[model samples]
Target chain A: MTQYTAVHGEKVSLLRVLGPGHVWALGVGIVLVGEYMGWNFAVGKGGALAALIACWAAGMLYTCVAMIDSEVTSTVAAAGGQYAQAKHIVGPLMAFNVGLFLVFAYTMLEAANAITLGYLVQTVGGMAGFADTHDKPFIVLTIMFLAFLNYRGVYATLTFNLVITAIAFVAILILFAAVSPWTDNVLKPHELLNGLPYGWLGVLAAMHFGMWYYLGIEGTTQAAEEVRSPARALPLGTMTGIITLLIAATMTWYICSGLMPWEYLGQAVTPLFDAARLTGSTPLMVLLFVGTIFSTLASANGCINDASRAWFSMGRDRYLPQVFGAVHPKYRTPFRSIVFLVPVALVFAYFAPLDQVITFSILSGLLEYTFMAFNVLMFRKMWPLGTIKRGYVHPFHPLPAFVLLALCATTYFAVFLGYGTQLVAMMVFYIIASVWFAGHRYKFVKRGAQFTMPWPRPVGH
Target chain B: MENLNNFQLLEYAAWGISALLGLWMLTDMIRTNRAHSEETLLSSKEGEIEDSLVIDPPHQGGHL
Candidate 1:
């Protein structure tokens, strides 16, 4: 028995309609086409062999993050995802930080998708003479269009996710067919061994691009509150999504890299398109183009859905304004937060460079990963064993979390050293969040808000 | 500094916007606190749950 009291006194709560399939769609939709565009940039950083090595490392990292996150979701099962878990496992202030980081990460990723989709449309359609600046009109329209669909309701949003994710899968299979004939001719055995053009350091530098392969798959947790049966569905959906992504990532790497020179693909704005073109098939390029469109649209749409839920959860907890926490009376969706996110995404799409936007998005996600891993350990320490029944538990408690923490720190350090400016920009964003958290603390104390950690105490302790 | 390009300029603008957002949140917090009084703020237990919904130990996996 649960209810919501919006600031305006409107009755609001999220409807539980999503099942395992929709959960899987939400998880995979946000990251289906990583091998399409931004991932090619990794080849530029680390060459073909080094990039593949980086990809394998990132895949393992995502597996750990996903398993640990599945366990956390089983406990909290709240819409705020990591933010909600952090509040229960850690405290309110850390939850606030996680909330803001989640919002920034998802919104930036959405904007990047819109920007790249615009570029793809221009390239695929062969539009001429509009290169004076990035296509602001196209990007803005895409954001508004996705936000509009989101505003309609969650059912429409998830339905769109399911459809497009299927299309993306089919598109990849066709793409494999397009590249298969040429793979034997163009792929060199020597490139496989001697292709570490930038050496070991390049692997570190290329990690962000490697992360593109499975960056947002853990967004499955964000859907915990909306799923029909969180206990059973969350673990199954998320684990299935991870395995699917790993297969897609491996296949995308092999076929795309083998079909064309890794150096050339590295520089390509649209890697799949370049791979299709290499086969010299007009129909194949068009097929891959459709897949690219589906992939970008699904990514942008799912980001809005996930980010708005995070914002809504924070507002419900009084971290943000109560207005942000409000769900639409008729649709039962977080319309205000979803609407607010549209313009912010459009602003980024218009002003920020695409590569910088991608880096910042991944960086913010890594920060959230570090916090989530820490929260896992905190939960174990506080709850101990046999105290609570969990549906899915990762083996060797704390080991996976520890490994994830080390990987996150190393990746952040690499990004700071390689891309200093974006790192600084994110730090400034964190500073602002900290300042707001301080003010929030002042308000909490002034208003005498009750604080409680929702963990059970052992009798002796 | 002399060779600052459009992208650099954009980054500065983004930083400025972030700073402004911080100030706005702080001020909004103060204003909300002033408007509602401690009594009204404490009356709502919107997100708090009655019992601890801690994670249950797995039936299969060994206890931590």
Candidate 2:
């Protein structure tokens, strides 16, 4: 009977083993790697000031996201994150698209992280005169090892993520302290700072890369069903995760902008690591190197855990296939889904260009945000606040929703400024996926069975 | 596959590890499938419950 609804406390479902701390780890783990590497691309686009503005701008977008996501995820409390929210709040077609967005976003990010891990190994080998070292082996090892941990259980997977994420985060703070000393300041913001080089257009262009600051932070809710208490842990974990990212992103931009001139800062492959090297501290360099490697590993690990869950949630509803929905008897995990998505991630990790792969990921995420903006608005209209018990109500009723839509539109335009072709390509990709789901697949979904949450019947229904 | 460099050999080893883990997951899943029905795997019903026995204590009353 409970199989019909996303009924909590089921023995066969994903285990309720995660706490707020683990949720923090999952969300932070995914996004911290961005700080260590890609966010500098914003500097390259706009200049130091543009990068900073875009960082906070994207931060504002994610703050609205975290607040809105917490409210919806708290009420819905399922595994697929926004996919679950869209299913419960909107309908099947929207839910199907959200699920695809999540799977592709995380899978692409996973592949990107895996590729970074392999390249980091090659860099290390180059330092050791083993310049011919192969990165393919490391990539394989990363995907396989992380998959194994996820296959084992959530507790182990997130616990492992927490340690490495914490280390990577501390490395950033240490860099900040070392560079920002009063009399002997290493970070010459006065010297490196150039007011927006490309002007407003550059600032807009920077917004797309600025998203890296907090892109995957919202993924904490993907483990919603598995959290010990969705109401408590969801808000606690997601909010704290955002706050951590805000601090980290600010420090990362400050440190990087000061150490390297805008031209070099914008293009450095590992900006934080490069900043550490510029300090002439071998200890900091090695620590940043390790930090970069660990952050990438943690990111890949979290991505596997998340991407598989989204795929599993879709499978459970027969949105794809029921076979992909099975929980492992002993592990209490979406084992089949984990197994199925591994090869897809590996294929991209091995072959695809990172820049294009990332554009698809960010665009997919942007599409989901578009769905979320409307989903939350509809949620309020259908359920009405105080009609149902909510764990956290975001302050200011429709402000967050309206702001989210505006931010999403702005980000989509920002994406268009740079990744215009990919933006069109992604829209085409999801549109086709949507049409296929609606035309060929909607018959399989049991709409009546889906709305079994304990909340009161929606106002109109 | 002949005359592979050390790095190429390492790649083979990594793939080998991945294959072993993959095969292990597959076989373990197969074992679980054989032991339980698809319905039990997908449903909330504890499929392992059938292997249990509720041992009834001979009431600890005045006889003790």
Candidate 3:
């Protein structure tokens, strides 16, 4: 029998209550705040100017990815985002892998945010020696708290995301205003060119850290199933979100690099704080710190929301156990999956070193990016233009997807040469996922109906 | 311990992700062809059943 309800016997569906603003909030909210910390590490690798170049490239990369993603989501309108799109273009096995990797990426990113939150609290509170053990509780608590926000309902979580996202952006703008007057010498050509210290290779090195500036823009599609009129909302929300991020990224690089040397900025964990301290303004430093906290909270909260949806989608499709597919009767949310992810994230945060976690997260994200580009190519061939109504048609045919795929392939080779162990770990993860999928096929088919690809095409044609 | 540059890491990921995709697509094509052939056979069987029903109707008692 075809299952009419959600898996686990619940007659539940994700409510389509989100609008363009909410979509924008989710998109920007997930990524905008990285300027406060991780992206600065790129400065160390490539000097300031090189890092800036890397950042710009990453922004372009995101813009391209988001544009293609917008087109796909507008048509697919499924809960699992890239995974769902994969189903239309590829086989079920591929879709299962996409969904699993997506969940891993989001959860890992969430854990990174939680760890950063712990560090931020430690810095602001002057908690020396507390990081060795005390940070664990803080990280765990942050995860649980974010999970609660998502479990309440989409309305509550998204409304909170919108409010906090606005405040965070305003805080960044205020920092810009404060730094502008002191930027005469800071913005000089000599200072900007100082980034070439490590030479051209530094530019490549900068990409890893620089990517943090706009890493999660593509994640917006994960919310498509929850959006009202996703075909219309996705493009508007994603385009606006990326443009805003680009502006914010440029302003941040200019001001932060201007105030301090690339080397100094690279070394500072709280780059914004160090920049404010340069002005001899105590108030500005405190305000920037507060903004960092808000941004961290928003990123973690948004990831929890997105990750649970991916997990729930998998469970609903019977790729995993159905228990994870259960929805809250009162809240109309995937409450079980949200609850399940908390401990898993905490374990990762507690055990893994921060840099390793970051590396792993980036790899997982790249996997999704790779396949999304592939899917775009395959989907266009399957449902050629004019066949299906499109929400947003990317003007240039296959160019963006081809470029993204090429970038991903080359970048993977580079990462393997640079960091073999992490590369091996990612490969191991895929191997394990493949094994589990093959073994579980029998159970999946017996317990749940097989999912059909919804895109229309004549089989023989 | 030298840290890998951002671009290199990206390339590394691309390598792994793309390789896996290539492998999966190859298998998917094989599966799709099998399914297509099975569907063709099923459709042919249905047509034969329809022909049998039309060409040979039930006989009336004794007159046959």
Candidate 1, DockQ to 2 decimals? 0.03
Relative to the unseen true structure, what is the C-alpha lDDT of residue A72 in candidate 2, on a scale of 0 to 100?
A: 89
Q: What lDDT tens digits, residue by residue, belong to model 3 across residues A1-461?
A: 11122223223346567888888889899897687778898888878888788888778678779889989888877777887677656867788888877888888889999898876654544443322233554576677667767876787798888988888888788888876645474345354456488788877777777778987788788787677678899899999999989988887887787778665788788787677777787888777777788888888888888899888777766677765665543344676678778778988888888888778878888888888888888878878888887899986878988878776775575456456799898889898888878886535732324344344663346
Query: In model 2, which runs have C-alpha deviations exceeding 4 angstroms?
Result: A1-11, A181-184, B1-12, B44-64
The estimated TM-scores of all candidates read: 0.82, 0.92, 0.82
Sorted on TM-score, best first, the list reads: 2, 1, 3
Instruction: Provide the clashing-pair count of each candidate structure.
Output: 6, 1, 18
Better of 1 and 3 by lDDT: 1
> Model 3's chain B TM-score?
0.46
Off by over 4 Å in 1: A1-11, A127-134, A181-193, A440-455, A458-461, B1-64
Which candidate gets the maximum TM-score versus the true structure?
2
Worst 10 residues of 3 chain A by lDDT: A1-10
Number of clashing residue pairs, candidate 1? 6
- Candidate ordering by lDDT (highest first): 2, 1, 3
**How well does candidate 3 score on lDDT at residue A235?**
93
lDDT of 2 by residue, B1-64 (tens): 6666666676778889988888887787787677656765676321122212211112111011
Pairs that collide in candidate 1 are A388-B56, A388-B57, A389-B56, A389-B57, A390-B56, A390-B57
